[model samples]
Target chain A: MNSFQLEVNIMQIKVLYFARIKEAVNYSSEDVDLPEDIETITALKHWLSKRGEVWANLFSGKLVVRAAINHNLVDDLATFEDGDEVAFFPPVTGG
Target chain B: MIRVQTDDFDMAQVLDDLRKHNPKVGAIVSFVGLVRDINDSAEVTTLTLEHYPEMTQKALQAIVDQAKQRWDIIDAVVIHRVGTLLPTDQIVLVAISSAHRQAAFSACEFVMDYLKTQAPFWKKETNSQGARWVEAKASDDEAQARWTQ
Candidate 1:
């Protein structure tokens, strides 16, 4: 394949959910195609908020939300590329 | 090390594994968290736990690493079970091995505190009335936040 075709075929993003967030979203993870400029965690949150009301409520207000990119905690400025695992959930209560 | 699995683990087996070949290990502290039969006012019969696989393991490892950095712990293990579990069943196990009891105890508690407020797991309880997802407890968060400062 040519370089242009290769670029077009690249997978862009993946969003993973845990606990109640998974149930609310009705998915464990999903691959998404996003524009190149959409790289930060905050931008991804805004894009996902458009998916439905559940997304809006889950991401809305002053809820304490935690996120990880490629299995590491990241701030809103964290960047991602194709095939990176991005996860979101409310504050955890494991123990 | 950390493990996230659906199957229950043997407490004796884990303890033995922690002390098997290590002679310098003078202390081993463990915390076993069981599925409770009550939540708030509800009578809970069972609980279903869910977690983000990659993130859960990574977050756990990070917590363990932090404990090692802050203490003199020789080894640590954290095992959290997912899926449906009955009351009194073990849901999580944290073990810390160190040359001193203080490090062992403190590290074990630190890991639990971090897990309670930072690790990505949720609990849903089912009883005769209905099934409900447990909400985050403010007290638990407060318990964890105190350690940060």
Candidate 2:
């Protein structure tokens, strides 16, 4: 539990895309190692938008996408932890 | 009970089973949602429901748990079918049982309202033109808003 040991622990998370977002991104789920600066869902989304065109379009507020942390719906400001499952999708349309 | 499956559920069998061996069950109110042949003036041939498998069942249970806490309900059942469905096919059923009609009626509607806006299921419509994702209607948000007020 020293500073050097803590620095060796990389933050990893599983990101999921559903429906149209999945289609656009061409990936249903992905594992990403978090950058030290990206601690919140909003920051993660902004970082994801830097990937390329389709990703930028999906994550840059162009398409309305809802997010969930570990299968529970959450706002963009929700903080992320290591090994969490974060999901993004459009509004739900079920009855 | 919450069942998220692709199999079509039989209304009569489901209803009949809910009241069995439970003498206090004096009333049952259920709502069934079916696939529509038309939506937004388009000829919708088929509807596909996609859901987060790990989330759908748990979210449904949470919804019913909320409904039960608010009302004096004996039991509740929620069945939401996923995958591709043809027009006129059954999609969802929300049944609530109680000793009185009022609680049954109110809880049934409450579950359906919450499920529409809160659950993770998404729908896509296929037609002669093409396939497109169904947009979440503002009307649905309005419908759920009524309950909170």
Candidate 3:
């Protein structure tokens, strides 16, 4: 493959958190590269779970979490591509 | 309509905006959520509300759409404020206008319920003890789920 093709093959994914999750993660968002097979939301969480204690603690077990892919609520099987913005948070409490 | 603004709103002006176009409107139900001075037994001095801008507007618009489907309402408006706010300050407002009172009331409550559980907004309260983030309540999900069935 050409160098340009190889560069295009690599994808960037961003994970954002809010409230307690943000505090626990110590970051509002982070960018990471994923293997070609790890394109779904569930797989992404599994990948993030191995990052460290903070991620494992927040994502491990049956924690109540919500996710949005590119600004829309999505199911666990949602797919991602290069430069897709993903967000994670606990249930909302507004109004 | 859904608006996320930092400036405070005038209730009379908003009411007039909703009622001026329709003479058949008989009931107008409105809910104003205030930033309280206390949370989780802590005395809150200031509160900051944060939201994902694009997603927040879309989610609120979806909730308003659902309310429109379930009720025969003439108009609905959702106004939410962000940034630093003090106690007793209005944080959010939901207004519904309909030909009858029950649809207006139910729609207003329904919109608020969906907003509480589905919309993306986080709040942090600062007090003498420092700052504490509010946790998401399980009861909120139950509240929104009731409308599905």
Cα RMSD of all models vs. native, in order, equals 3.6, 2.7, 2.7
Scored by Cα lDDT, where does model 3 land? 0.86
What's the residue-level lDDT of A93 in candidate 3? Answer: 66
lDDT of 1 by residue, B1-149 (tens): 78999999998899999998999999999999998887743678889887877678878988999999999999999999999999889999999999999999999999999899778888888899888778888888787788889
| Full ranking by DockQ | 2, 3, 1
Q: Candidate 3 - CAPRI tier?
A: medium
Model 1: lDDT to the true structure: 0.85
Q: Which is the leading candidate under TM-score?
A: 2
Better of 1 and 3 by TM-score: 3
- Per residue, candidate 2 scores C-alpha lDDT tens digits across B43-137 of 89989999999888888998899998999999999999999999899999999989999999999999998899989999999998889999999
TM-score of chain A of each: 0.80, 0.87, 0.83
The list of candidate 1 runs beyond 4 A from truth reads A1-11
- The best candidate in terms of DockQ: 2
> How good is the docking of model 3, as DockQ?
0.71
Put down candidate 2 lDDT per residue, A32-57, tens digits, no spaces: 98866787888988999999998899
> Which tens-of-lDDT digit does each residue in A1-95 have in candidate 1?
58776676444777888777787889888888887767888888887788788888877645657788887878788888887888887766676
lDDT of 3 by residue, B5-112 (tens): 998987778888989978999989999999887775367899888888869999999999988998999999999998889999999999999999999999999999
Sorted by TM-score (best first), the order is: 2, 3, 1
